[model samples]
Target: MLESLSVPKRRVAAQFVLPGGSSRKVAVFLAEAVPGREGGERLSDLLNGSGPRFIPAHDAETDAMTFVHRENLALARVAAEHEPNVVDPFNLPTEHEVELRLVDGQALHGIIAYVLPEAHSRLTDYLNSAPPFFPLLEEGGQHVVLVNKHHVAYVETLRR
Candidate 1:
């Protein structure tokens, strides 16, 4: 009980640049009361494991290393629990000015709005999961536009 009282709050703020040419800001729980190098370490581990690995992790059955994004795994859970075509009914998404650079050398400029994650929410990973299409508001919020995840190459912030 004393530990609970002494524990301070913590969280992680992450931004995802989806393959479909769209990006979104996400917030997730840190699972740590006092944040440190843990998050950076986790990201580093992921990056290091991306390439081929000839050495055994201790056995011949071990395969080459793979880059795994935890967010992708979390997205699966969210997708299973909700309808993919329609977003869960929540508060209106926040609008942000963003520029998307596509793999085909095309670009899309608009305001993307998404439901802000709950404060100090640990569920940010689940929220980062890439959907088939991201529903964004464009044309000055006059149209509900769908940005396919597969088509996106990268996303950039027009303004901080």
Candidate 2:
């Protein structure tokens, strides 16, 4: 008799701010094996693999675990295979076209549409000319800051 292989569940929690100024929570589960890979690698495989087609966005971070607006459709489909309950309520646009003003007084515009949650406030405040923004780092046995999907300026990933 053959034993059945039981798959472990994977869960990702995130919060998003819609274009209408409303905030919502989202949870998704990627394949257990694929989720462990680096974000960029996973996305590359997903796109190049013979499974599905998802557009890659420039200006999007290549290593974040979160999905951006442009990738909403592809992510949704992938998530559905594992957990049908996971869905992207906000339809992601083909690209993110918003103009961002960085803390260094530089304006940046890109089609990237998602960011880490923990970096949201800092990014927002920086864009508003409130303070400087720095990437989170660990120093002296302590983390300098915590970055989540919200804190990111945009999202990127293919699948795997």
Candidate 3:
């Protein structure tokens, strides 16, 4: 019975800034590693594998979790019953369009990710943090651009 408890679950904490100036926190669980895998494999596996979970934050005053809950939930079902493949989220190049409104009164348009919630990154990785710069693909789809997160006022996902 003790063996069953050997697997470790990690608490993943994330804070996302809302469109309005408020921010919210989210917490979730992720297995530290597979039964017999290499070091740092847990995060990679969780991103590509079928299991990762969210425990909900201890302080639940608002619905800030609502904004990022979908992606978080999708990461946690655990294990692949069918195939054996792991996705390297850090390198994939798929993208989603989003609009960023800056505190300086400028609006920038671009694509935000290659993989949503990159490997080892909480699904909502960039929401509440200041970045060296958030790199993105510009709307013209020609140049790679970087935005300073400090100037980020709000974000809007422009579904295409």
Candidate 4:
């Protein structure tokens, strides 16, 4: 049996850039409270392995490494969950613009923005037309969104 874990209260925000070059912001509160295990298995799978690995790129002129592509996957998950109306890839605003107020007495907030349809297409293409990257959690016999910290616009961990 899994030991009862304390759900950490967290706040998140994000910004997305739409194809039209416009941006939108998203904010929310996340806690262990979302409900049953949603994307936990998938997340675990992604993190379980030796974490992320780095491989040298073939390009001699430029040097790059390959990892789990956590950023892209995380963004894709959020987009899949919210289906933001707009996404802006360039000139993203700072986290201060977006804020998430936690009702569980956990203070948190920030901003998240992404580049629109183009980004979506690229991500979807990679995910093989899978549902956006958002994870689902059981809440009152219904599924709800469980935001991940990696992609959140901003996160503040309060002092206990």
- Clash totals, every prediction: 5, 20, 3, 28
- Model 3 off-target regions past 4 Å? 1-94, 116-123, 128-130
TM-score of each: 0.37, 0.25, 0.37, 0.21
Compared with the true structure, all predictions reach lDDT values of: 0.40, 0.31, 0.46, 0.31
lDDT top scorer:
3
**C-alpha RMSD (angstroms) for model 1:** 14.6
Which runs in model 2 stand beyond 4 Å of their true positions? 1-7, 35-160
lDDT of 2 by residue, 1-160 (tens): 2335664434444333333234334443334565544332222233224643333222223343444442232111112122121114564322223443322233333322223333443434333432122222222222212122233454222221
Which pairs clash inside model 3? 50-78, 51-78, 52-76
RMSD of each: 14.6, 17.1, 13.2, 19.7
Question: Residue 8, candidate 4: how far off, in angstroms?
Answer: 10
Consecutive 10-residue window with the lowest summed lDDT within model 1: 74-83
lDDT of 1 by residue, 1-160 (tens): 7886763433333333444434443432222322343222221122223433221121113333323343332111111111122334656545567776657665767665555466623223322563455554444544433454555677776775
Q: What is the lDDT of candidate 4?
A: 0.31
What is the Cα-based TM-score of model 4? 0.21
Tens digits of per-residue lDDT for model 4 on 51-132?
3432112222222322223333332123333222232445442211233322222222323323334555443242244233
Better of 1 and 2 by lDDT: 1
Candidate 4 shows a clash count of: 28
